[model samples]
Target: MKKVIAIYPGSFDPPTNGHLDLIERGSKIFDELIVAILRNPDKNPLFSLGERRAMLEALTADFKNVRVDVFDGLTVDYAARVKAGAVLRGIRALSDYEYELQMAMMNRKLQPDLETVFMMPAEQYSYLSSRLVREVAKLGGSIQDLVPEMVERRLREKLDPAIKLQDARKMKPGKRA
Candidate 1:
């Protein structure tokens, strides 16, 4: 039997629990799930593509059917190139559905064979988003349940370098950023 493959594309600056929820559920629905990272250079991302890929890899290491990859240009084209049966998306709210629905229709127009599957994250994660996670971390707020432990650590390292240095100095007598 031919494998049923689906592509899940996203920026994933820091993979949050909500994203993981979708990935976990999507993985079960498809024979092979490709977690493709969008190389969008237009927007400044906190984590590099490589970093995001690594985080995803680590988080999904246990899922043998799920793989992490990167791509540029149209997502539908990428899906076609990979021979994906569907483009999987996670919709958290109506606002997201409005934008994603338009994109899904556009993609369907481009590749009639490729279908778009929309999945919702768990209820606890309904209101979670990477943007909000970044904002909370930037403001030095707790993000314990928002993202994975590794991502939380990385976020603190990236957004609070000065704070870390100040903390270290207080602990010792010299450390600086």
Candidate 2:
């Protein structure tokens, strides 16, 4: 089998179970699966860069061919640097496909050689997303089913009742950006 290195890039805000599934599957197709945790400067992530990387490393600790790292810049730029065979993307639904398709095309334009391979995960995690997981957890709801045990605990730590209450106290009402 010809060895190929694939880069799976994402913010991995907390690296949900869905993300784990993608990495696990990506490992089988590519000789090396690099889980590049993106440091998106635009959004205020609930977790810090180091915290996000730690979560990802913990989640994919068992896969022999799966490695975790962080990248700050355009994903296509990083993919080119690592000579990635193709950018690995997970498609959950039609909406997701539409967005990912746009991104893949743009990446292709940026670098003609770089391609994107879309992987559809198993049905169990087809609807799972970090956004919904965070919303549920932040509202004091159980997230045991949405993520791994360690990730559940970590999510709770960041969205603990005490911490949430403290944040609410710090919020300024009727403030416009």
| Per-residue lDDT of candidate 2, residues 1-177 (tens digit) | 767889998888777778888998899889899999888889788888898888788778899988888888888889878878788999998889889989999988888888899998888889988888888778756666668888887886877895465456547577431
Per-residue alpha-carbon lDDT of candidate 1 for residues 30-139, written as tens digits (9 for 90 to 100): 99999999999798999999899999999999999999999999998899899999999999999898899999999989889899999999999999999999887776
- Local lDDT at 3 for model 1: 84
**Runs in model 1 with CA error above 4 Å?**
161-177
- Tell me which residue pairs clash in candidate 1: none
Kindly report which residue stretches of model 2 are placed more than 4 angstroms away from their true locations once superposed.
162-177
Which clashing pairs does model 2 show?
Answer: none
